[model samples]
Target: MAFNTSGFNPVIHSSTGGGSTCISGNVIVSINTPGTKLLYEAPQDQVAVTESFVELFQINSTFGADAAAGGSSVISGEYSIFVKLCFPNDPSGLDKIKTVQLLTHGATLDYTYWDISPNYSYIDVASAADYATLSYDQLGVGNSDHPDPIQTVQATSQVAVVHELVALLRNGKLGGYHFDNVVGVGHSAGSMLTQAITHSTRGTSTP
Candidate 1:
């Protein structure tokens, strides 16, 4: 809820897409200090479905501006940016598939996961079922790789994997493992998967 005012600045940029050309030049401005949770409001002009913006955050090295000789670089601080699209008066114009694509593509290039320091890690839910199978195989007593059997449900597709993630995030055996430090990021359809898991986690009581 509190803002990180010590080191903070915000920049905004805009562009036109779809079949239209860029009308107004992209805008960029810096904020002296801002809240941790920042929102980028879309512009009123360039009201066509094609115009959009992107937000980016730059994280400075924590160690130092420059890496010490024969040593690793450090992170100094972090920078964040957000961009939005301006659409015509049409209530549903913002939700159009083409407009969404333009916005997504622009934002993707502006902000990349790899740019963030201390690379973030996530549970590989894509192959959760495979991991479960391997876990079961390792538990069998007959095989050298086997020891004891553990119960697991099969997750054949991304949807199933998402369901499993939601269960774990909510009331599954590992539910207690949830913590504030965790961050979730997904792309394209993966975003929907994360949303489903997130929705399932809400309003659930801890055992």
Candidate 2:
């Protein structure tokens, strides 16, 4: 994976306690892979929704392997992902904190899901605990760029985006902070994406 970033926020002071600070930026990620085209159609009603799932399950069970065996032209695109990094004011030392949490939200949500408010924000909670947090709006959501949903915004591509983010954090490219340990935290569909990252990048550098 290769990426470029722009629109970096120098510093955004948190109004919440614990003297936490935040910085946000947009990253443009590009990857090359066979494009995924789903044949399923959008359901119109509750019953149709169930029927659509059943139909998709049956189709996958029948032709999934054959489809996987087929080859196609690579689909590639650059997606701008909006991300925020929050940490406690390091009065003691930055070296004391070497771990960062990578937060990913489920479908129909964005980065703000982790930061609903000062009192309820997970970023604030982590900062108060002396830990840093990184949250991002996945492609096609929030402030990020939107490409063809079925082709460029597939699960593999989503994993690729998060993977590059981990690289940036480990290499201190974002906020000039290098974290030896990066953790993955996700909700619902985001959890599946994180699991995919762990599985696909096994025996390789990943969160």
Candidate 3:
């Protein structure tokens, strides 16, 4: 992705989490239902799971094939994610990075959505304000790993990855670029994802 960092370090991080959800297009509607708490957990060591998407898909859909089963969507296995960061052009010149805007893009789009500088460049504007910026692809999109659509990559899984990144940022583990005032910015469906992150996390996120 084209970056505005005249002179700075850019950091990329990968996160893995799985055995999360297995949803088809129909189960998507239940996302907003009340009392819908989902499972989302990851290892701190960053070790990815070895199961394949195809295998997980078969198992999740084969619920009726077993005595205790019926067709299902709750998924299993390790989920991999990728995210990129852009620091201010001159870190020394800026005050201890005040605001960090975490960018989450919508469907069919990669992390490049926020970097389209010729248009409304979120990165350029934030960088001009000395804000550290992070833009990432959802787990199943962009540079992140691709898994079975029915076995993983649901809204909960997507939000789970965001939470993981927040922990990394707060702890100063993501490429050494740390900021307590992290903000989430998203577009379209990503806006929904950012809203999810904000509700689940203590920090601020703008949809």
Candidate 4:
């Protein structure tokens, strides 16, 4: 209930799919994850961005996974991520549930992609089914903090952010709701992040 609401939209209703009320806001997340070097130099323009991608692909194709192999240091940062938490408008038992779906959007898209409209809104569908939903703008995308693109926002750091978010949801730090269960849902690149989180054994020993 005491979530940071700076520059956040107040409560809103989704009527197209069903009557679902959502609190659109932002949360500050801090995380530490293994870091890797940028495969290609940072681009200066749109064309350069494309060229950088091409170069990265060529290097990967030529060297396979070895091209990206390297020792990793711990990368840490505090970032603000835009998030929306929604629940069914009707007074069903769903409001008391602690389970939630954590949604992450693909590259080039924001949290809005999940709730494009009432008719096509994923949040509305979940709400009607008596499930709570939480969607966020991944770091370096949309309203979230944008750090050094090539260095700080790599795949490992993105996965770390998602893991941190899952911890927050489970520990009752986010939205003051303690969710014992978290289901991660992602699109495209986001799906890769979720997969990494699912299969990761990074924090096992905590050495």
Candidate 5:
């Protein structure tokens, strides 16, 4: 069952009710094996040291999803993983106190924190790039000009990409795209987006 990789929608997100509500948007997924492998290496402490952190409060309300899925397979079925890094707006530092809660199928998951150092350091490629350049815009609707808003776009795109990657793994089309197992890893805004992805639906639907 070879899946057609073409015609897939980009993942994106949107804001509703003055930041109180957020709907999923278009999402885009990229595959980076080297980076993904480095993220999961060795002792938990080692992984923490190697990986940088993103500050959610400092990040803007709008964000793009450019997640990368990669890994090698062991035996059990196939494994696919995606990583999202988010930086939120927190000039007052009050937002840091704000914690994001994750829910899957309407149940609350445990609250987790990322290893954020005093001097925040996370590489963001989109910062340099123009938001207009992205496939999705803020509408939460679809368009070639702008797929949807950044947040929804990222979430939806991540879901779509993960779906495709997992489909590939299940069918054994992805040779090295395998792993012992798979799980969602996110920090700050990325964590929020992961929560959205975990519960989002396809084709212009909001979750």
Candidate 6:
């Protein structure tokens, strides 16, 4: 149903052409979840944040942002997210555009994990199933801004960023293509993040 692509390119676009769809670029998003953002703007403060990150991981308190701040703080950053849209190479693939599957990868990995190689690709599978697909780099990962990983890059803020991306998908901002439905599909921590986004956007948000 969707076969559109344009500028906003940051990562590589397919050289093969026409069998699939892809749009990528740097997107700046502001997430308000309460944490420290000041450290990233300074040198020594950045080191302190890194040290704190190590300590938190050592103690399994990576979710300690809310506890440390006793509340929420604004965590905003410029992120490089790619919406690799899969349109079926076949004519019937057009109907796949009606519903989109948003893909997110786990920690120690990025979006490309889903499309490991030509031998196996989730995006290709979704396309063949008549389901449009979406995959992006999680905020603070890959080409995204590394905002104080211990504080600003915690669960709350990351989930909020996903919500923002959902909104964009619904609004047809990534490319000229838009879908009537969207489903969040993730792996490990990425899956957990999607669950949080689903719970939080129950009121009035789409996708």
lDDT against true structure, model 2: 0.76
Query: What is the full ranking by TM-score, best candidate first?
Result: 4, 2, 6, 3, 5, 1
The runs of at least 3 residues in candidate 2 whose Cα sits more than 4 Å from the true structure, single-residue gaps closed, are: 1-7, 15-19, 39-73
In model 4, the runs with Cα more than 4 Å from the true position are 1-18, 56-71, 92-95, 201-207
Local error of candidate 1 at residue 58 (angstroms): 40
What is the TM-score of candidate 5?
A: 0.24
**What does candidate 5's lDDT look like per residue over 101-160, in tens digits?**
221111121111221122221211221221100112111222212232222233444445
**Candidate 2 lDDT over residue span 71-164, tens digit each:** 4446677777888887776646556889999999999899888877657788878877888899999988989988876556777778888888
- TM-score per candidate, chains pooled: 0.19, 0.78, 0.60, 0.81, 0.24, 0.73
User: Largest TM-score belongs to which candidate?
Assistant: 4
Q: State the C-alpha lDDT per candidate.
A: 0.23, 0.76, 0.55, 0.74, 0.28, 0.65
**TM-score of decoy 1:** 0.19
Where's the lowest-lDDT run of ten residues in candidate 3? 19-28
Clashes of 4: 0
lDDT by residue (114-162, candidate 1, tens digit) is: 1222223111121111111001000111111211111111111222333
RMSD of 4: 4.2
Q: Which window of 10 residues has the lowest lDDT sum in candidate 1?
A: 130-139
Provide the global lDDT of candidate 6 against the true structure.
Answer: 0.65
Give candidates' CA RMSD values in order: 23.9, 5.2, 13.4, 4.2, 20.4, 4.8
Model 3 misplacement above 4 A = 1-77, 118-120, 202-207
Model 3 per-residue lDDT at 108: 75
Candidate 5: list runs displaced more than 4 Å.
Answer: 1-154, 177-180, 201-207
With a 3 Å backbone cut-off (N, CA, C), the pairs that clash in candidate 4 are: none
Q: What tens-digit string does per-residue lDDT give for candidate 4 at 73-183?
A: 567989888778777777546448777999988888888887776589888888877788888888888878999886788888888887777877777776566787788
